[model samples]
Target: METFFSNQKQTLSRAFCLSAAVICLGATNNAWALFSDDEARKAILDLRKSLATTQLELQGEIDKLKADNAELRGKIEGLEKQGEDISSSQKTYYQDLDTRLGNFEPRTATIEGVSGTVQPNEKKAYDDALKAFQAGNLKKADEAFSAFANKYPKSPYLPLALYWGGNSKYANKDYAGSISQLQSLIKRYPNHPRIPAAMVTLGSSQLESGNKIAAKKTFNEIIAKYPDTDAAKDAHQLIAATK
Candidate 1:
């Protein structure tokens, strides 16, 4: 009976020991699961921090780009304004030059007792032609004007002298000679202010010379080239009369 009681107590003690081991294993497993959850949470927080840093860096780059763009735009606007100002200044300068060139006039000769400060020959020749014209010596006027033109081919008055010589020829009943001389004047003085006058004379001479087509052409040319001049107005009247 004593041996049986000792065996029973040993069985009970083994059962209790087995129960304590099972409880200890269950607690260790739960603690290990809790530690794993904490590590996963830490990793998630680090990932969120990394994402925030990347986003901030991207925003900084965007801000820098905007500032650079603004600076470049300002510079471009300044250059455009400068270019416009330069263009306006250049236009004004050219306009002033054109005005000055258009208003220039030749100085007159025949100063004091002397013929002229420059070009004494021109003064003498011109004075001789005028005197003959005033005296009503048409033939002598023609001779003086012809001599002036021939001797002073480079003179500014050469065009006027030729023109008056043609008029003198017409007055002397030399219509064919007048036509020839006036045509020569028109050819010689293309840009002269007296060109319209020469054209009118040439047209009249051409009409007298029986060159009706040439007369019409000269009248039309004067009206087209010198629309604002009195000679053009006269040419138009004569053209209407002829037609």
Candidate 2:
């Protein structure tokens, strides 16, 4: 019986020791599992931080690209405006140059039933004399026309100038000068359009200068040459009155 009790005690002690060892191993396993869980959580947090930092860098790059694009667009707009201004200025310059160049060019003109190419200077000189006549400055007109006739002896305006100069002299009561101009015009341009008027002026000038005989002969010549015309009628009246 004592030996049996001893064996029972030994078995109980062995069982107790095995139970304690199993408890220790279970505690150590629990600690190891907790440590593993903490490490996994820390790793997740580090990954989240890395993602946030990368997102921030991407956003910064996007903003910088947008800013650069806007600046480039503004520069392009400014360059376009400058190019337009340069084009406009060039057009204006060319237009001004063309206008200035047109002044010295010869042009076609029709003067006193004569179509011809007239130089700018020649046309201006003739127009100036005509302007003087139209302004009623008869003396200046006469001088200008006479100078033109002397300067441009072969000008087509010669016949008209002679006629106007003679009339200008008559208006100034320069009867001898008028007669001289009229006679020269008649001798030079016998078939001129001012012939009838020149004949009348000559006859009137002769009558005023106390040469009724010459006036009568001129009036008879007009009646014979230009019959049934107004000048002929005027000549008839003058001849009857003078006789």
Candidate 3:
């Protein structure tokens, strides 16, 4: 009977050991699965951080490019303005030279079935009147220019004579006479080189006479008809001021 009891105890011990080994194996497998999940979570977080950093770097580069674009635009605008100023100066110088040379050059014109020769004395008279006008002697300049216009209607200097006469009238505050003379200039000398100046003078006279509507019309005509001209540029500034 004692031997039977010892054999039963030994068998129970072996069963206990087998059950403990199974429990340890199962616990080891569960711990491995938990470790794998933690590693996967860490890798996912690191990938998200890298993507965010790349996006921030791309945005910084875009901002720098925008600033560079703005600077280039400003430089281009400045260059265009400088070019315009130089062109305007050159145009004025050439125009003055052309006006001076026109005195010595005798031009042919037909008037009333007769062609008359322009005299050197006529050039002198016109030049003297112009000098007086440039020196701001409006009264004498007007008298001289009027005499020239009346005496030499068929002269090649007629268009310039009429234009200068109108300017003198404007300087003397004779707005009506200025308008009449400038209107005659436009009608007679539509293709004259000094027509733009005449138009600007006419517009100025209109403005001086409290004819705001007429002035606006004249300025608008310049911008519409001769937008690339210096006269048109000045008219635009004056109109903007009025507005």
Each model's lDDT: 0.80, 0.83, 0.86
* Candidate 1: residue 112 Cα off by (Å): 21
Q: How well does candidate 3 match the true structure in TM-score terms?
A: 0.52
The pairs that clash in candidate 3 are: none
Count backbone clashes in candidate 3. Answer: 0
* 10 residues in a row with least lDDT, candidate 2: 111-120
TM-score against native, each model? 0.49, 0.52, 0.52
Q: Give me the runs in candidate 2 sitting further than 4 Å from their true place.
A: 1-119
Question: Tens digits of per-residue lDDT for model 3 on 1-243?
Answer: 999999999999999999999999999999999999999999999999999999999999999999999999999999999999999999999999866666676655543333556754787888989999999999999999999999888787778888999999999999999999999988887877778888888988988888878888888988898899998998987776345
lDDT of 1 by residue, 1-243 (tens): 999999999999999999999999999999999999999999999999999999999999999999999999999999999999999999999999755554453334433221322244465677789689778899999999988877777666677777788888887868888888887877866666666887787788788777788889889988998899999899989897456
Measured on C-alpha atoms, candidate 3 has an lDDT of 0.86
**Candidate closest to the true structure, highest lDDT:** 3
- Model 3: residues with Cα > 4 Å off, grouped in runs: 1-116, 241-243
Return model 2's CA RMSD, one decimal: 12.0
Give residue 183's lDDT in candidate 2 (0 to 100).
90
Q: List the residue pairs that clash in candidate 2.
A: none
